[model samples]
Target chain A: MNEKKSSAGLKLCISDLSMSFGGVQALEGVSFEVEPGTIHAIIGPNGAGKTTLINCISGQFIPEGTMHFGERELTHVRAHNRIQMGIARTFQHVNVYSELSVLDNIMIGGHHRLKSNWIRQCLYWGPYGCSREEQMLQAEALELLERLEMRHLADSPAGELSYGQQKRLEVGRALLAHPKLLLLDEPMAGMAKQEKKQLSDWILDINREMNITIVMIEHDMTVVQTLSDQVVVLDFGRKIAEGPPQEVVKDKRVRKAYLGED
Target chain B: MEPNLTDKDAGTAAARPLLETRLERYGAVGLILALAVGSMLISSYHLSLLTTITIFAFSAMGLNLLSGNAGLISIAHAAFMGLGAFTAAWFAIDLGIPILIAIILAGIVSAGVGLLFGIPSLRLSGLYLILATFAAQIILYWFFEQALWLTKSPDGRFVGIPEVMGFEFGDPWHYYLLVLVFTIAGAVVYLNILRSGLGRSLEVIKERPIVSQMMGVNLQRTKLIAFTIGHFYAGVAGALYGWHLQFVATEAFDLMGSIELLVMIIIGGLGSLAGAVLGATFIVVVPELLDMAGRRLVDDMGLMAPIRMFIYGLLVVIFLIYEPHGLARTWRKLVRYFNKKLFKNKNEH
Candidate 1:
């Protein structure tokens, strides 16, 4: 919020974050800072706790450390309440409501933002009631779909879409929440080169235009190097290197952990 | 489905804005008129049949919202109905409340009970939730039989002639109108909920609970609300049933009755409102159909009963194996087919 390098979005601060599943440690003493409005990518090889780190930040897992989003501490926040504080996330795999229409799937993402409750929703026919709210949400969903180039698939069930489309649908769903901090787990997973290129462009557009800070777990080092402003390399649940993308990717520890190097 | 352009025609029927169209404006009025006209045209015996179907359909619609849409199964819905019926009886006989007011109040009482039972759903789901609700069915059924204060007797308590707004419902036709009004209201509410964000939240919670929670849907609150509303529907149906038979009994709210409600929603279609209505009608008519078939086809009474029962079991199997989605999906397919043909003809014209 200060003269902190074009920081219009929330500053995400994670310090000494550690988590374990019983005997197996998923993340350990991992720490990183995501500058506001910056595209911060968490990259690692298999079993490197990149997804775990994303989950911890999104309040899926309670890790041992401090996670501050702007002024508030999100260490003990419930998963449902996380989005209320402008923290929205996509799953590593497709976790969208596939049974619902693409538009409805996105509309449901903004459920917390909707003003109508049980009474208003049940009695939706009063003067300027839930019906009006529904129309507004519907329009917003359609617009988001249009942006995603999925306007034609608005009425189609999410299950009917291609794997790449489903991934994009998940992103669009997360976007509908209007989160200040967007956590994307493998946004380019199962995508073709062309699809990845398009998604990378879209990510940059979302960061610059929407002023949302993004923390993404990416397997593709090429994408990690190209798209991210900052990069954190994790090897076996520990942060190996963290800096600007170019600097971190060139680090000896990062190269040893990520690429096949001595 | 067409592989083509036309951004102007991007909207599908589902994509259309909820309740924004002129057709949807008069939707409630149209629904009431249909129910009223349908009831008026039926004879006494048919009126009784229609009323029974309507009452069951009303309850199944409630179950459908929970089991069908929310993906939460409850085998204790009949007990909810029983609770409502008994509560209505208490209001009418003990407190001297208006039957109409009593019915609504009875629903509220059932809803409260539903919320109590729905607590187990927070930690339990799928088979566990079913078992939990099954326990609810048994426990609530026992309460109905033993609670002398409500039931008045082990046999049953007879509900008096239901009077609403000075109009006594002594005639079967008069009572049928009351049930019709409630069923219409149920259908309307069911539709309204499905279109609204609240309904969509339950749906998301059903399909993807983690994602739903991450999206900020309070899982516990949503599930409880569903149970409360779903039980209210069951309760209203029970009250109507009580008034229809002039009796409220534990026998009617037993485990078998709960299974019957479950079958109604499953056979009709899980999530479809029409499925709830159709399933109720199917269940009500099937027994009458079996009896009629048995009498016409066989001479010996004992043999006829077994033969009819075998056929009934066979029919259920055939429906499940073939139409797993239920009657609503089949009905939708037929409607879609007819619409397509109609559109083709229109194009030619």
Candidate 2:
């Protein structure tokens, strides 16, 4: 099956983003540029503001900074509108709608693309009826399921899925948005070794096949080292190192921060 | 590696076949048949009882969508209903409009009111949202009492028997058919909406607003839609109530009425359409049944009111303790049992 890559992904530029909660600063003067069609990983220890940076980019947390996606300013863009602009993110925890069927969960990710009006939807008329749009949505959602190798689980309630499967489902949901830039927060966390390998392979395939840029937060050093094209290391809400994984890992500050050396 | 199935998976798997069985397919047919049999077998007085149940069921279904599906509590649902009732009455009497058109107009007016009150829900949720709806109830009640021109009920407003295309619906049997048709239509609309994208979005919003936002759901728009549709159902029910009683009174739609509607959805099953019907029947019929039983022991209607209220309170408490998911879940369980017993062989293939 052929997948269309829209816009070849867009550059994401974050300039001097600062965020604090009460007395604790989560991300301070954080600046970075994620080039189009590349896997960018943000790695840091606990409370290092890695997740906070993702939140700021996704518009969940407003910070003192300017953000640009492609040439479009996104600092004031609402969270819901960010998806329409081809930016999608998953949660630190697997946050698929637990009560919905797996198919429905994926279909929801395609909501911004469905153009059926409320009246047509209420009456099941026009595109909202048993028409092209309806069929297309179902087909697209099924294709997404097939891509994740989760076609058999489409009818199952999402919450009933195992933790590893839920994480995959979350990724599939974000992919359904056809995002130019995908932000995955701990996508491989809490997975078994086999499951982690499978997820890493899927993430690699998603990046290479779909040509979608990715910004991910992961503590799995091995996966980050193998998959990331660029790595940004954070400590105490500050960027400690920004380079390729091999060099960043060898950096003195990164090693000291990770090993907690005096 | 073998798939890891949790207890929830086991439970849902056990229940899945029941939902998919032939019996489930016939559920709608069964409901229609029951309504048909009821209309044919019951006496005029009992037909009135059925009509009242059907009317209340409409309002309860609305509340079910708002409180059950959307996870937004509304104590002002009856106020939306009351708005519909008064609007229909005003249209029918003051403007000399047709009753059918008046009923439709009433629904639209109530939807408008619902949209107005729903603004608060976009910013508030849980207890705060509930409190806001309660304020709506009080405000609407005060509006009904003070706005004499709108209500035209200084004492109590008497509405003429509704006539649609020269057919008088004053007779219980005739009104029963009307109410039954409207109720069924309302149910069809409710069920259809649930299958729609808008309905799914509302569920997403209810489950996780942040996740929903990430999934591109407009939180404010979805909430407003839920409120509008839910209250449209209420408005239709309220107009039907006016036709049933042929009278309008401010006291009929007080906070207690709102609470009663909420109770119906709670006892019937929140978020289930069948539960809405079951709850409406329970709230409406159970009280009359109790009143009949109580009348044998007590003497006056005035004295019986308090006894009825006491019984309702007791029943709600009992339901909360034992069947919190409400009668709909109980009904589903019973159906599942029968389906398993009757269709076990057929389903195994």
Candidate 3:
């Protein structure tokens, strides 16, 4: 495992990453670097271990690799602390606090970023209140909700919303964490065509407007081709192609691997 | 954000202030009426029994905070009660602190000790946490037994009755009113806390600890707070218990007593205050009723007195198997059924 250093605009860099689950190797010497302010997609067919690779980068697994985030080495960092260091992720299964209101759900994402102590929150008085800081977080969260067009459901419980709405809210939550690098795991897994289009546009808008680099695991080739600046194609836990989406999607190995050459 | 209000929230907000202000006034009138009726009709023995029932209700209310809302299956609650009782006794006997002050101090001390046990178990969860607290009970119980200088070595002696402003709480009726007042206050405070962030955090931790951790909820702090606060109530109950009993001992707060409290919460309902009261009432009253019937049956068939205990044990088993959610859910179902049936035409779409 070789640790790579990130330049000024580099978002995340991974080198010589290998992870094995018992007898099976999920990722074998996988390497990729995502530049800041771009959409980087990792796409693969069924059982290709695309998600497993993303999970490793997100610090869900202690893989045999070196991961660097904004000049900081993140290979040995825990999942929660990795999140704290501006690397936030959304789960594939649209995990949101169902009992909490949609706004509260997003606010929980901002909780880790909050610098106030428990005493300040408990007392809630002048000077220590840091009303400005709190308002800033709220403003940012509300703006994200408004941009996603889910602001109307802010007061409603997240559970009461439709599945598509829940996924959007989970993304909004990840965004609220103030991530420099957002790793989205199958954001368009189960959605109507219109919903998928809306989510795709939102993902692109977030990257362009917020200047947050996004590394996404997408199964939809059309979505990947449209939204991603560059695509990393993985098959059977190994990268088969890495280049611009047009070049990588048309590569013989990728075409055969994705479409069954046999 | 604008305070987005649902219909339920709007209705509750409108009704709550009125409910809050009027409840005590209405309750006072109702209580006065009930007292008049009871004093005129009921016997003195039954009145004494009612007093005991009220005190036990208070103790159960304390247990409800620990078991009901927090979802901690604590078997060391009775031990907490004993800690409170012994603390009160020692304070009154040694320092000559007034009973009210002693009770408050005892509660604080008990909460501190509960935190001491709870902190260690914060990292370890579920049955492991239970085992940790069970060890606390054993250690605390052993200390009470062996520490002859404080507890006078197991035989147990009577503590002085609390006399406030020359009014001795010698009668069961006097102590009953005092206990009921504290109990109501405790219940109200508990309810308020349940509606607050503290309560929400506990529910979050109970339902999904990993999610709460990810959301930056301090798991150790929350667990410690719950444990300490729960035992604080238990401690208060113990003071009232000791005052009511007029004695303190190892036998009063034993493992069986702790188990009985757990049974009360389990048989009542795990997560509701009403369930705790129901369970406690069932535990206290049902046995007496069984004993009365048992005496008659024994006279007729020459059965043993231990048959009542057997019956009680069997009822607990049956309750756990058939109605694990306890009588609270039964009451909820009844209410829902009535609402749907009687108010069908009135319900808005």
Candidate 4:
């Protein structure tokens, strides 16, 4: 497959990665490379194991083969520690702190960045006088909210937001982690066209402005075609096609997988 | 000079009064006023009862953090309290340490023990974690009963009168004041922790462990901290219980005591400071009130205990089935209803 390029800028590598649940093989010998500072899209029909692939990369699923981010091995890293190693992710379904304010939801995303000890937090003071670290976190979280045009909803409970807003908030939350590699699973699913356009714009802006590598699973062909630098198409837990979106979409096998024809 | 306020600023300004109700602003003042009035009106016997309620409230608040906020159910809460009581007694009597230091040391020791028991929770949750805590309750109660070095007395360990500086807190009145102060301090600390990052992390972890992990919250560490902090509060309550009664016994902190503390949090509201206090008062005073009524209705006072237990069991069942959120939620609903009615009438006028 074009010599499987492995230059210095390769941000993520998955080799011979296989996962199974009971007797069902969700993924089998999947291999891919995501370069730094680019948007890579994985598209597939139902049960193509797109979500499972992201889960394996995010450490929720234990796959058979090795996976690495940069040079660091991520195969055995705990899910929480993966975030510390600059890996962050959003779910297909909206998962947020429903009871907490929108601001607090994003501040929790910046948890690893804040260095104040638990004892200091208990005392309502930190190394930088009293509550300075907390204030800094608040400022950072507010900046993210402003960027997302959600500063007006800061004090509102996260659950009270509209579904599209919740989806945007989820992205803002993951961004607050300052991840080098962000995995987004169906981020634009269930959104109207206008909402999808706005979200696509935000995603592109995030990739360009922050120089963060993004690996996303999307069912929207238009989104994949417009945004992806590279596209990997999966069918039945196997890579059916891999290339730039324009070339991959025109492939006979990808069409067969999507249309169920020989 | 006049300020230029934007639409967003005006929106937030309009929302402020709607968000911050009278109860939200003056709730603390109301609590203090109630406590002061209660102290003045009650007899010395009733004063002791008030102190007992305050002590239970402290432990209930602690348990609320674990079971309510962190979503880790524990049935060994009183065992931690027993450990604290024994530790305080040993330090105060054997080491001749001051009572205040002894209490703090007791809390520390109980927190350590709590951390040990909390290890199982790293891998277990819900009913499985509750079972682990049940094991802790049984084992710790057995240890307190068998260990003569710690218990010291076959009947029970008798703690000396607690003293700070030159003031002896032997009198019920003085001791009531001491308990009140500690109870208020405990409530303040509980509220502070709820707003802190650590507390928020626990809530996230409890709500969605996988999501919390993605957000960079260490699930195991946060769970362990919640368990330890809960036990620390329990220890302080136990030490206070020992000082109030001048006694500590294995029988006092048995399985029943643990269940009672759990019941207190459940009935009051799970995850709320006010709920803890309300539940404590209900659990402590309800039986006494029932006994008083039984005295007038029937000549047999012996039947009162069983009747109270039956009623208590019924109340718990009713709450669990009908109002799982507990009394705090019910209170909030009532306040909201009244506020709506009052505001509706005003708007019409």
User: What lDDT does model 3 reach?
Assistant: 0.72
Question: Model 1's lDDT to the true fold?
Answer: 0.84
TM-score of each: 0.92, 0.92, 0.74, 0.90
Candidate 4, B1-349: lDDT as tens digits: 0011112322221211211345544566787768867776789889888889989999999999988889999999998999999999998888888888999899989999999999966899888999999999999998997888999865569886888877898677778778888888788777767766777887898888888986889888999999888999999899999999888977889898999999999999988887899899999999888888898997988888788879989999999999898998988787667666666654321
Give the clashing pairs for model 3.
none
Q: Write out the backbone clash pairs for model 4.
A: none
lDDT of 1 by residue, A164-214 (tens): 999999888888888888999999988899999999999988887787888
- Indicate the worst ten consecutive residues by lDDT in candidate 3 chain B: B11-20
lDDT for B47 in candidate 2 is 80
TM-score of chain A of 1: 0.95
Best TM-score goes to which candidate? 1
- For every prediction, compared with the true complex, DockQ reads 0.42, 0.31, 0.15, 0.32
Residue lDDT tens for model 1, B173-240: 77888888788788878888888887898798899887788888888889998998999998888999
Clashes of each: 0, 0, 0, 0
lDDT of 3 by residue, B147-230 (tens): 777676675557867876678987656666677777766665565444334555566677666655545556667777788788
Off by over 4 Å in 1: A1-7, B1-35, B298-317, B340-349
Q: What Cα-based lDDT does every candidate model obtain?
A: 0.84, 0.84, 0.72, 0.83
Interface RMSD of 3: 9.1
Fraction of native contacts under 8 Å reproduced by each candidate: 0.55, 0.48, 0.07, 0.43
Q: Candidate 2, after superposition: displacement of residue B268 in Å?
A: 0.7
